[model samples]
Target: MTDTTSTETAVRTGLFIGGEPRQTDETLTIVDPAKPGVIVGEAASASKQDVADAIAAADAAFPAWSALSATERATLMAEAIAGIADERDTDAAVLSQENGKIRFEGFIDALVFEIRWNLALMLADEVDTGKTLPVVPGIPVTTEVSYQPLGVVTVIVPFNWPIAILAAALPHALLAGNTAIVKPPPSAPLATTRIVQRVAEKLPPGVLNVVTGRDENMAELIQSPDVAKVCFTGSVNGGKRIMEMAAKTLTRVTLELGGNDAAVFLEDAVIDDVHLDRLFAAIYDSTGQICMNAKRVYVHRSRMDELVAGLEARLNRVVLGYGLDEGTTMGPLHQPAQKAFVEDIIQEAKDAGADVREYGTLPGGDLAGGNFLRPALVVDPDPSLRVVTQEQFGPVIPILPFDTEEEAVAAANDTWSGLCGSVWTADVEAAQRVGSQLVCGYVWVNDHGATRLDLRAPFGGMKQSGIGREQGIEGIRAFQDTRSIATIDPEALAAMAH
Candidate 1:
């Protein structure tokens, strides 16, 4: 993709408040993960006062924005979606520059498509509405339930796939008659802030807000009493802290937390070199930064060697470097710190007696400068090891041997987080049965992360993964209030009043 913005043009990089773009004295430098030394872009660092201003905007605009009919809200959402699409190349370029993802892989191709996929979820469903009310027992009276807006919502998104997740939560909140304050990840705020600025013109003032910063400034925004609800996506520790802060204001929250998802390979599963390669491609894509990335692989002891050998051979062909390079299957870790953390864990796994081997050579002579780590596969990993159990958000996979389907399901569910997992087997009944046994919000059979769910599927978790849903008709209900209105005939009312 090309940079659509003219060379002479200066990008309006700042905080978005009240449907306007304004800069702050404080600025945050966004790094290019591909070349750690290069400064790709900068975003305004919102102060406490800026956050207060955003909440104030949300508060002032909520009444009008919410007063519009669902059709009107949906129209504005559709316009914003179109505007975002118009800025696709620009957004993609900026995303690649700031995120250190390859322009095609990271920006236009991989994530923008996900954003559009999420956009399809924004179109409200008329069928799900107008549900009939249940009749009262021992009486001819009836009670109906309707959805109402929850007021101003604050969306705090994580770094990886910021645009997609924001699209996931924001449209649902707005369509339900609520305004939004979007807090982009501090590390890569430029793309999101700019996208919001470009699209804000399509909505009424205060309908949506974007604030960027590095510290607790946004935390105060999430905890503000003026903010009605908070939707967050990040690590478990970060989520816990946000929940605690939200509790002070009794703020409603939807926490999409971390995941330690796994993939199970049964002995009966059809095995071929081509199939194994395709599976590795899905897992290692995006350097395994995806929340649902296969962090752990449980293989039957009988086929463990075959799977390991196939994975190692396929991984050897992956081209690892900056995302912009052609055929670069593996990009650098999102940050230098992330690279260090992944390396530490890999060494830890090796120290734990697991045999570790690298597939591709590190990129360039200056591998130390960039945040790249060669994709690695650890064989015969102990189930209790940190690499096997924890959410290692990197291009590392740990292989563990399992004896039976029960053991595989048990191993998959033995985690603090339950976001998503996958089960592979030849028997249709076995796949469905074992898939149900794994404790997760979403599961894939014979697949890794592809889902065909519409806006009507509830997207959330049961354990530490998250608190509330964020897709489909169920998601819109999350941003709404259910009130019971009771009525009776005049004579009955008189008798009840008496």
Candidate 2:
């Protein structure tokens, strides 16, 4: 990892609007989450006027951008993507410092953003592909059905995976011929702003923009009458707030919110070394900050001991430290508040007589002050415990044991969140049966978590988790509106009149 402290000047970021980098009188100081007192960078704190400017810029650019052919837009975006990798190392290191994720995960975040961008680009031709309907006896007219771009769009991303989550909608919106303004998470905006500004610079002025500021300054991004749609990926409450604000303009919204995903292991589940490794990573990767990571694990009562032993072995060997530290396997929780929240949840579980086993040791010296928490497993906790029932967006997870497949599925579906769920079993048929029964938007059979997610498939939550889907053809359509053109057919009209 690059030594961020080696340079005398800290990384400074500014808003990207109208293809220019603009500075703000007030700026947000971004610190290394792993070492909160150490300032890593600063981002322009967009004012209310700045937010309106971004929306106006996107609105101004929308007509020309939307007029372009899908192929033209795709070609320009491809050119921009080709240049994005030039600063990968620096960007990833900054992300690591600011987001409290291991360096490799930080690198993967940017890589995944590019991957999703390319994936969305691949669907360019399909954006303008319209279907023709033949004349019907009763209708007496032939019609053409087409998808048209919504105008200016606002895309708000969360702190956990800002760049990648922004890509889930940004590229698709732009490729579908809409102009976009991105609002990166306020706490971890430095690296995301740098990356988005780079991409925005290569595009047409106002075709893409980035604004970093407090939530209070961003009301216009959603409620502006010029804005056609808002794509937000964040907490459930945040999504609800976005919906309420957007409702003023009756703007369309695509929300990818929080999830308390469940992973079920059937009686015939494979608990081999490889499977255990995958399971461990699924539960604890990025220090368990991912929205889709398995928050609760439901194991067959027969294999509960085996699974617990395997996870314990892995947990005992974890190394917690700064994200850039080579020896570290897991970094701290992104913020001190989250650390406190997770600690409280674990204490609550322990008070309820659940066996809360925590592993790993915090590093000494300056690192001691970081938001570090040992990875923990709550063994066979009561289903009503906060760790089991709530979205524990931290490194602690609850493991519950069930006797029957019906019970496992019931327990998994009991949560208000239905984002994603997985079934683990050697029996493919059983995997299908149980996976199909889980009431989530996406289900994985035999494998689980973001590592196993299919980018080409649509991803989102059901119920309180989220309102709409992202990725695949469905994602592109989320940024668009359907239109129909019809003309009277003389012969068919005469026949129908007769």
Candidate 3:
């Protein structure tokens, strides 16, 4: 990992509306999550009028944008993406400072956005591909089935993985011929706003826009009559709120919400070095903030000790420090409230007599006041404990032991969350059998987590986890509406009349 400490600098960002930068008198000061007192940058605080202007701009651009062929739009998007990598170094440093992930993760966040953009572009030709239903031997009607753009769309991304998460829907919406207005989370808006503005600058005016501000000023983004669809990636409660707001206009919505993802290890699972490393990264990568990060681990009783030992061996080497520091293996929570929340959960488990072992040394000096917490593994806590049941969204995780494959699958599916789950085992048939039973949107066999996620596959949740899928062909179609054109064949019509 490259050291970005020396390059750290404050960023000032403005809203992108009608493809131009618009300044606001009021600004929201964004603080460094690693050092709360440190000001990372200021973002333009969009007002209700600004939000309206953004929606209006997107609505105005929808006609021409939607009229163009998917191939034409893709060519323009490719040109825009070509220059995105040029400023990645600076953007990565900015993201690390504000969001508190290590610089390498920040770099990867931007890179993933570009990767997803190209992937979405690959489906341009198929976006408009329609099927013709020929008149049957005795039928009189011929029909053409096609997909059409759904005007303006609003895309809201969460703070955890702003740029990468935005890519899950933004590019697809544009390629589907819907103009979009992106709303980056207020707490960590600088880097996202900067990157989105850069891309928006290269595209036609009003084709893409960005708004950053307090939640109080964002209702119009979702409820406005002009917004045909709203795609949001955030908490379950937030998704519900978005649904309520969009209900006013009966606008369409696609929500990718929170999760309490589980990882199950069968009795025959391999507990070797490679598998152990994969498990560790799957659980702790991004400090366990990822929605798909394994929150609870269920290991068959036979492998419990080995799995715990392997995790501890890796946890013992964790280094908590500033995200820009090259030596830091993990950074602080994105906010103080989250740090306190995780700490309270760990304390509650310890108070209940669970064997909770926390590892890592907090960096002193400048980082003394940072929202830092050592990574912890709670060994076989009561299944109902918050550490096991809730989405920790931090560096602490619960590992429980099960007696059989049936018990493991049951334990994994017990939660209300159905975002994702994984089954690990050497027996291919067992992996299949257990993985098929896990009640989640996507299942991983032998491998797990975001690092192992297959981007080409449809990803989402079930029950309260989410409303619709993002990515793949399914994701592209989320921004479109279907149309059926029917014509009566003269000969068939005459035959029917006779």
Candidate 4:
């Protein structure tokens, strides 16, 4: 039980814990990346003890929540989805204010779609009863396999897509009958907490909770022993550290880590002016903040010049600014460290003999107070440069020209991460063949980043991207413990003994 009235400020801000709003004196200032002096709002910073208390509350309520029939749980989850839908515009506005994404084209629609899709995923499979089996010449035996929830799920959402990452873990956890504790990324905490508060009100006490804080203190909340499972979305290094910490209690983890995805453009691919424009959008959308962002492009040496020219022209037109501004195409990186890191990568790539050509420009000088790094394009003199190999999570595109189809495949699969990739070709058969050859969890053919992710399909990485799947039936199964039940009737046992 929470005091909803206490958490609501004049700004309509609140934290949800145990199905109600919670307030605290500890303040976390939300910063807008584009405008340095513009403070979005202040969010309550939850202490380690607050996190622990939430976990304990979840633990206390787990038995009742997890024992609910699947249908019953799904019904509640449906209502939660409707609640989220009702608050869509409000959620999008705050998300844009905090994270600096263009609300209309980028964050708003995607967040709504992600939540809606997750809800559809929740209702994909119904509760199945035990199947009747023949027992010893016409007698019937019963065997059953049904999904069960883990006790309490703790979802740690990253800054890039606060609502989407929360949706990735929240709906599934609740529909599978698990209580949840959501810790939004520090930079954009208020928007996510507000979203959680809205949805949590419709749930039972202890069924949902939201906490906000700085990065160093965030780990303490995640590694707490009271949490039964954790679903984290962030960088690979951060995911590794979380895994190490979670090892103390052997908490079940679903980590959606970073990616160095390859977009292979084959010789047979037809790249007209229109398709090239769309391809550039696919690569640089959200200022290349997505984990599946196309960091590297492999085009046939024959068409390298054409591809570069087309990409350069289209990228030059992106309108960059704060998310609140109308017609803003690109937004600033949400934090100072991110801007610094991207700038470093761009400079390093140039230093390594790559031809650096930037489409967008940062108006403020370095150390400009706000985090802003514009879109950059790099044409590598040496195809095997570090810029082409590493995962630079920014709007920096590296174009590498390859000679043969085998070479293109080799270049794409050479990365240590295998999260997602794309292949563009007019020859459907060749494109399919190349896509199959790429070592990635998702392969988009003839396009990029538009591959449909069905809820029934398992979602995860093959190599260093991460371990285990998070969505689909496998996701629900990930939250369960299986036991093999064996029994023999007295007559069958006696016959076996004789």
Candidate 5:
């Protein structure tokens, strides 16, 4: 329910509650991250009452929406996908304003990664019914397995990769017969809200809803009696809070939280354009805000200097500015708070005697006031340093050289965040061997991120990275519960008992 009549102005937005655009007197102003002083727009500041209404709407719609055939559900998503293409340029611009980077890449990834994952989940209906195993013989007794949607689903999207994260929760929930309420991160809600508005308009009223508000609204949604499942993507601490709150209602939860993923380059690894380019992209993409980003680089002593030189040389070409700028390859951190957090980590690493080689130069004008920073590459930081041990979630990474296989494996696995990682080597066997030792959900051999994501593979973090999974059969199943049915013949049962 966006105002299509005016495209030039700061398009004031409202909460998409109960399938309609509902507004409140209190609204939060969103400013362009690239243009700090310029206002992007104002979005509804959803109060607790708004959240309760959204949950009620979703609860009311679940019975009918989830009862629809898989084909019908799939059609709704297909329509949304087509709408995405039509508004790609506009959404990209809006996305650029709300967040400093990833509008283009995020949009493309939604099409490539999101839609692909959506299609896989669409097949979940058939898979759930058609793929069940035959019951063992029990003299005329038959047993069947089936999947049922988990009613109302609450999706909390992170600001970093909003569209892609939405795809993970919303579409699957709808296609599997569940209704959903989405809470877009306020920091970068404009573009994400635009995308949600498109989907909400296409789908039946109450099937999908989006809200913008403070943290309390989310807690309310998670603890709502009607919400059956909650899918969240953000910080580990945030996930923990959600879990603790949801426990009261015993609502199901899936968390895709933070990561301190390491990229290990073997002694014989190729340091040429192919590997180095992908490696750099893995760490720098989204300004290193991605959950699966390579936060630590472990290289063999033999090739440490070469890798550093290559990374620094590539860093020279990076331009930090507005997302839409053709020459701008990097962008500012969306949140001002993140700037201080990242700075503290880097400064702490430096204090620990780490050799920090920083790159890129901040420019003036609109970019000067923006949250810009030269991406840092710290060398030989103490293993216990914050930069080395915790998830940076910013454009700063640490590189350390390892002497042996045991040292490299120990160093890579020495973290609570086990989201993902990579192993670089000429020998596939060698890479495979080492990748097996890394305690992560997925370990790439030569590259990283969405480029390496197998469409049907399950995506989730291991250990403290959080529980459950997203994507693949498991992903669709998360939105569903199973039922076992059996038909027993009385005569057969009596005969068997005799």
Candidate 6:
């Protein structure tokens, strides 16, 4: 569990290419998000040349890696999973420093990646590569559908849940027989860097690679011809740029982008103190930075007051401090820019004559230098207000009242971003009826974000929220292409005639 890099690493913290660390002339200092004045470590600020090298390495390894049998790949994935387990504590430490989340959250994220990797590897053998066609009306031939991997997959990831999200795509990509060049988020690259270093060493050279850099280098990853497919998790604008660039090469792309997920409470929702904590955690956990966090809350008019009060009481209890502090349940926003963005949204709602309430107190001793903001709750805000209509993506929840189920559904589906929605009601059948009306990818009847996912179910977004899905068979197949193989033999045809 001892990580030397935690102490301002010795030299050579750079790109891990072809199973080796390659130093670069320029480097970026990773800062502790909770206390910006503190330095975590330095990583190579990869340039275009560095990106090209990584892509070349991935391209070189693609053939053999892709040619590996499913069992072989699964064996390697299991090895990589073991390697990751040994460094879980160290990696979680580094992740906590830059991610500005509690150690528990970082550890959970590390374990999340592990679970996902195992899921993909376990599902590897079950992936149906070839399926027989039963009779194609009037076609006197035996036909089979084959699933093949796209070559090199370039994964562009964001700071939030980098390891888990990368696992969502990269492990499955490898399971489908493809190499990967990963661009770890510059702001919080150390933990993932350590992960890839160990994983790459366990696998063949170029099978897995990691690079850290700015936007221009990401552009290189997108436009490179070596990449046959792309998986990106970031802002909507960034996803668009990746799509536009990948289009030049006709590379397949899967993007998990921004989401303004909504939560609804029917008249019979369990709003008692026992379940109120769950309701608040759904909205405020991860400082409300999660892509699918409950950004909008629509409650029945009778229960709106109770929901707001419960959320406010819960927020007031959150202890904001350094991520490493044991008392800290909620941590600061990832960056100053994000703090300002959330502040602006609160201000916009205020300008529109909405009553906004902020709770919690920042630590004056250790975390005063961090990008910390108390939770904000906008009550009865204007429906069109930015805080209500747009995705604030911070610790701000705006509760609006609905007179009827139809009105609640309309208000919930009114937003342009439809990633996820949850309906809270005691009546299972009633919740189902309301959930069915929601225009989102994943609809929860009684629960919100509790980290338990039914892997068989597809999860993603609708509208401008994102494209494509993650988790389940549908997700694994996104990295592959289908080919139809047909054969017509005179002998076989004669037998069929008989």
Sort by lDDT, best first.
Answer: 3, 2, 6, 5, 1, 4
Please identify which of the two predictions, 1 or 3, would achieve the higher TM-score against the true structure: 3
Better of 1 and 2 by TM-score: 2
Regions of candidate 6 where Cα sits further than 4 Å from its true position: 1-12, 135-137, 489-498
lDDT per residue (tens digit) for residues 402-424 in model 6: 98999999889988887888999
Ranked by TM-score from best down, the candidates are 2, 3, 6, 5, 1, 4
> Least lDDT summed over 10 consecutive residues: which range in candidate 4?
1-10
What is the TM-score (0 to 1) of candidate 5? 0.94
Ranked by TM-score, the better of candidates 2 and 6 is 2
Please report the TM-score between candidate 2 and the true structure: 0.98
Q: Pick by lDDT: which candidate is best? A: 3
Return the lDDT, model 4, position 134: 38
What candidate 1 gets wrong by more than 4 Å, as runs, is: 1-12, 108-140, 365-368, 450-456, 490-498
lDDT of 5 by residue, 1-498 (tens): 243212246857788978788888888788776666877788888988899999998888888887777777777767766646676666666666677774566456446534764566457446346333443445556667778888899899888878877776666677788998988888778777877877788778888998898775567789878899899999999899989999999999999989999999999999998888898889999888888989999999999999999998889888887777767888888888898899899888878778988888897886777888889899877788899888898998889999998899999998998999899989989898999999999889888875567766788999889788887667777888888777776776777787
Candidate 5 vs 6: which has more TM-score: 6
Position 429, candidate 6: lDDT:
93
Mark the regions of model 5 whose C-alpha exceeds 4 Å error after superposition. Answer: 1-8, 109-114, 121-127, 130-141
Q: What stretches of model 3 exceed 4 Å from their correct place?
A: 1-8
Name the regions of candidate 2 deviating beyond 4 angstroms: 1-9
lDDT of 2 at 173: 94
lDDT of each: 0.76, 0.90, 0.91, 0.72, 0.81, 0.82
> For candidate 3, lDDT tens digit of each residue in 342-423?
9999999999999999999987887888988999999999887999989999999999999977778888889989999999
Give a tens-digit lDDT track for model 1, residues 1-498. Answer: 124332122343788899887788988877677775666666788888998999999999999988887877777677666645666667766776666666664454335434643453455664125544544434444556666788899988888778877766777888888999989889887777777666676789888888888777777677788889999988889889988999999999899888888888888976686568657855786678777677888989999988888887788788877565567777788888888988998999888878988778778764457888888988887777778878888888888898987888888888998988888888999898888888989887776742223334677776999898877666777888877665544554455556
Displacement of residue 264 (Cα, Å) in model 5 is 1.2
Backbone clash numbers for all candidates listed: 4, 0, 0, 0, 1, 0
Clashing pairs in 2: none
User: How would you encode candidate 4's per-residue C-alpha lDDT over 98-156 as one tens digit per residue?
Assistant: 77666764345446445544554555455323243435643333344444667888888
